[model samples]
Target: MTPPLAVDIDGTLTRQDKSIDPRVFDVLRAWADEAPVIIATGKAFPYPVGLCEFLGIPLRAIAENGGVVYVEEAGEVVYNGDPDAAWAVAEAFEQEGYDLGWGPADMVNRWRETEVAVSLDRPGDRLRELAAREGQEVVDTGYAYHVKSPSVNKGTGLVSAADGLGLDPEEFVAVGDSENDAEVFTVAGESFAVANADEHARAAADHVLDASFADGFLAVAESFGIATQ
Candidate 1:
């Protein structure tokens, strides 16, 4: 069997407005019918799981930038790091008046299981400094800054999920459009970055698409000879 396709959710699968393109959804649904389609994203577990529910697809998801994995067959989420450690770091930042919140806009400071996401406006350098001091890891997802453990990331989470499913890492393709996705690009045998991807992400990818968002994802699927119908 072809290895599953792991894709980032926000900028790669949806538009800036957080809306899924109908055409893209159509292709995704069709693709899911033939092979596993894993949702790899920086969002919390529920967010991507919610998307899968909305699409009526029984696909697994990697959330919190690899901090959590939701295995569809298991119907449970597996956490990669210590949630208390992440919260401790968040608390320390909060005491410093950092105004830490979950994500951007309405989702700001949303609660997560294994990681904490703060609005991107916060100083990235400070966050990194603090994380280093606490022996933690920080990654910018373009939408938010996530604090997690060094052991976990999109790459590790993707590998964990694929291994659990008995899929070969080299058979999978990863697609994304942000700095946090750089690690994912490194782990997958084939990686693609959308036109809107950050320079770092593009550099890490095996292919860079001219189109943005879902269009770019569709282009990637076509290039891999994956049927969109």
Candidate 2:
């Protein structure tokens, strides 16, 4: 059977410059034809939902790095972890005289409902401390550091999505390129990391691809005999 595919966005589906690779549209759409193509990422809610809409795939996503799971087919929008963790972190940053590193009118976390994403350019150690104080953990997703509850992650989101789809989370194949995707690697039946994957993601992946970014994802699809072309 064609197993479900759970994929990350920023470093998995995007190019090196962080732009969403249009080349992946057909490949992911093909995977969706066989089974669900789950867009799992640290990105905000609308990002993946918009991708699904354009890719013509099921509007299923594990957003906020696992803090939120949206299964459109099941009409289920599940919110996990500490709902106020993001806000708490924001408040803490204010107390610490930090600007969240985002300029005024930050749009990054504007639509975020659960977790907080800190710019990688900021002070990671300090943000981690604040997150820990808020009963949250900081996950490095290559592009940014996510401040979120430790309990909810891509792994748990996959389980919830599977339950809604009547599939098994362990039967799914996960692919990503950063630390936030580690738990998903553990939960999936098989895990893959792109050539550009970070140490945490590479260590967690069952297969490390030769290609990077969208090319790596195409390699994964081809490995499963799901031809993208």
Candidate 3:
């Protein structure tokens, strides 16, 4: 079987500002021709899917941390999964007054809608302050903020996507740099942490890469013996 290459977007493949080098996509385009190189991110439906298209690579994607899974069969996304478990876990955090945030899957078409919010669970102190100021009801999940949707998170989302793809967790390899990426690390056969990863995420990852985004991505990809253009 062709091993699956699951890569993170925000702080892994792209820069911290989320910009992609043209060559990155070019490399991805080449890799896609060889195997299933998927984008696994905490982002939601449209953007993640769009990124794959922009890269000119139509491999499978585990988006919103796994809340949504997409596989391009013909020309567009053809598979999806819900974050039921994520909802439950998020709810637990909300009940604890932890100020939870839902990912992009919860807001699909309404990404621009003000009523929807995404929350960040890390940088614990910052999150706590935001929770207090935003009334525990207003915090950005790197997308938007809404109180009720706190039950959403990335790790569980990735699991749902893994299941939907019918790929064994052991066949997948995830790379990330934050708290949200914890689950992907757990499920993947191998996991990597970039040098700039937050403490929690770095601790959770199976291996720590020597470089940061756009800086070390090629080296890390090569470590997996992946062919890069």
Best by lDDT: 2
How high is the lDDT of residue 20 in model 1? 72
lDDT of 1 by residue, 61-145 (tens): 9988888887677666678887787788887887888777533453644547888887778877888887887778888777888
For all predictions, the C-alpha RMSD in Å is 2.3, 1.2, 6.9
Q: Model 1, 36: alpha-carbon shift in Å?
A: 0.7
Poorly placed runs, candidate 1 (over 4 Å): 1-3, 74-76, 101-109, 225-229
Q: How accurate is candidate 3 locally (lDDT)?
A: 0.58
TM-score of 2: 0.96
The TM-score measured for candidate 1 stands at 0.90
Better of 1 and 3 by TM-score: 1
Q: List the residue pairs that clash in candidate 2.
A: none
Residues 4-118 of candidate 3: C-alpha lDDT, one tens digit per residue: 6677777777776778755567666665676667787656566777888777777567655444566654233433332333244345445666544444454442432112233
Q: Which candidate leads in TM-score?
A: 2
Candidate 2 wrong stretches, greater than 4 Å: none
- TM per model? 0.90, 0.96, 0.66
Better candidate number, 1 or 2, judged by lDDT? 2
lDDT of 2: 0.87
